[model samples]
Structures are given as C-alpha cells and as structure tokens.
Target: MLYDIDKERSALVFIEFQNEWLSDEGILQRRVIKDLDAFRDAVRTGARIIESARSNGWTVVHAGLDLRDDPDYLLFNGGRDVLGLRGAIPRAGTWRDKGVERPAPFAPLRGEFVVAGRSGASVLKNSTLDPFLRNRRIDTLFLMGFATHVCVESSLREAHDMGYNAYLVEDACAAFERAQHEHVRKHVVHHFGAETNGAELIARMEG
Candidate 1:
C-alpha cells in the first residue's frame, strides 16, 4: 500500500546539492561522482518536489553538511576530502575540526516544521538536527537528494529515533553505485523502517 499523507503538513528536505558538492572538483570520492546523473535527473524530480511542497505551504528546507571547531570531524569537515571537498557543501570554517557548528542557512529555521536533504551515512548522527526538529513538533521528513547510502541512510535512522516519519525517494535519490543503491534502499525500507518510494508520492502531494 502507498503512504497517504497530509501534504499540507509535510515538508521536503533537499540535501547537499550545493555547487561545491556537485562540481567536477567536488570533495566526493571519484567513483562516487560516476553514478550521480540519476541524482541529476532526480533534481528535476526534486524541483517538482520542492515546488509541490512549497505550493502546499509545506515547509521546504535544505540540509547539506557543516561543522565548527572539532578535529574528529576533519574528513567531513574538509581536512581530508579526497576530491578536495572544499568546493563542496561544508567549509572548514562552517564545519569543524573536532566539534559541531550551527547548520548555516538552516539555523534560524531549525526549530520550524520542515524536511531534510542531507547527504551522507549519518545526517543527524552526531548533529543537533534531531533535537531541533523534535522541538519544532515536525514529525514527517521527506528524504530526497544525493549520495543515498551515506547521508540518506544516516538521516533516516536518526529520524526514527527523533520520532519523525521518514520517507525515502528512490527515484529522487541515487547511491554511489547500482549495487550500493540497491543495497541501501532495500535494507532501509525492508529492514530499517523507512517509507519506500512510490512515484505517486509527488503527485498525491500536488493534489
């Protein structure tokens, strides 16, 4: 059966599609970029998602990556990005060397009802987003965007504990490889407790 949700009360989260993240010079693994056109195509789908979310007056928000002053998060913080991620979402100043920073462009809206587009294996793993969303009483998250296995899976798991309904857009997202995408999508929806994608998800909301 499909999820019959209240679109007016829902939100769309567009994770990590920043210029820096998608550029030819991104900080992502070289092979990771290979399977990204699906995500690119998903952009058009995501745009529709955003427009529909906004049209319904559902909160639409963007979430990528960032940190503050911690050393442990250096890799994700831009210290050891193999693709020279400096051109990606999180900046050293914005992310951390060993700690967490406020989610830029997302701080003020943090406590409001919304969605997340985070890209990584753990969007809310060690971040303050879970608490932030809970405080806002926002209970549904439409997970859409890139690098599925990594960030997408991460956020879905956390949303479970954060007590929000998490939905993954299979068509709206892509993993690092055909294999990876299949694995993660199957695992999460079949075993991890996330709503699997149904093309009509976008349509029902638009109605």
Candidate 2:
C-alpha cells in the first residue's frame, strides 16, 4: 500500500554514513564489510534519495557516531560488544578520525541538520535527534544507511517506541553480509515499521 506522506511532517534521516564504514581506509569497512561494491551501490541509492528529498523540500538529517571525547568509556560502557572486538570497535578519537567523515555523496548540506554525540547503535540514543524531530513536529522518518541490522534497526525500534512513523529504505542500506541485511528485512523490520526501497520512497515523496 502506498501511504500519503506529508513532506512538511517528514524527515529523511541518514545514519552512520561515515568514512570508517564506507570508505576503503575506514576501520569498520576494512574489518567488517566483505562486499565493498554492494555497499557502495546502496550508498549510491541513498544519494539519489537525498537528492529527491532535497528537491521535494523534505527535512534532511545526518546522524553520525563520534567518540572522539569518550576516553573513559563513560558513554560506551554497555559491555555488550557486538562487533566481536571486545569493545575495541569505534576506537577512541573516532570523531577526529578520517573515517568519521561522511562520503562525498552523503555529506550534509549547509542547512541540513547533522546530529552528533552518538556513541551507540541507536541514532536517538544520547543525541538531540529526538528533540530535534519533536521541535520540528516531524512525525514520519525515512531512514537509510550502513549496517542495516545494527544502527538502522536500532533506530527503527526506537522510533516506533517514540511514536514516529518510520520507514526503512531497504535498498539504501547495507550490512557486512547480505544475509544480515535480509534477516533484518524479513524478521525485524515489519515488527517495528514498514519497508520501502529508495525508488518507492522517492516516488511517494514526489507524488
């Protein structure tokens, strides 16, 4: 079913598009992403979505995880390391690390909101994103980006709990393995929100 989206009440959120995850020299990319070409393809699709959003006057947000100042692990002391590196992932100085930068296609524009201070999987955690959305009265969110099963999933769950209508752009997201992405789409996404590809989402926005 095609839902009528109010562009004024919707926001397109890009999560974890940092260099560390997408670029060749990125620590997470080198360590986790096996199919670089496939991941890049997803990012390209994301770029097209962003362009559509911009042209349609939809709100744009870029959420990034920057741990440059968490030397004491105060913000990341969960001890449930999923990366299997024993809490070594998202290394200190990641904020200043070259990997923290967004890829050229995903970079935020002059007026676009860039949310930071995210030290965890969920973009809404410890970040002003929730309040930012609330302030703008944005009720619908279009989310896409790296690690579909991780950060994107986390945010989808949280957004549901927060009463926002969340839509996951499946083709605009990627994970270390194709199976991981499929698992989220098949099992996780429907429970929290609906799934739409970049093309469908853009079409909805334009329509």
Over the stretch 62-121, how does candidate 1's per-residue lDDT look in tens digits? 666543333354445444544443334343333322222222332324334332433345
TM-score computed on alpha carbons, candidate 1: 0.68
Candidate 2 lDDT tens digits, 1-207: 348778888899999888887777777788788877779889889989988888878899999876656544555453245353225653523444676788677788988999966656789977889889999989999889978988899999999999999999999999999989989999998899998888788888788
What's the TM-score of each model vs. the native? 0.68, 0.89
Separate clash counts for every candidate = 21, 0
Identify the runs in model 2 with alpha carbons over 4 angstroms from their true place. Answer: 71-74, 77-86, 90-95
> Per-residue lDDT for 86 in model 1?
38
lDDT agreement of model 2 with the native: 0.82
Assess the local accuracy of residue 39 in candidate 1 as a C-alpha lDDT between 0 and 100: 55
Off by over 4 Å in 1: 29-31, 67-121, 126-128, 196-198
Q: In model 2, what are the clashing residue pairs, if there are any?
A: none
lDDT, candidate 1, residue 6?
60
- lDDT for residue 40 in candidate 2, whole number 0-100: 85
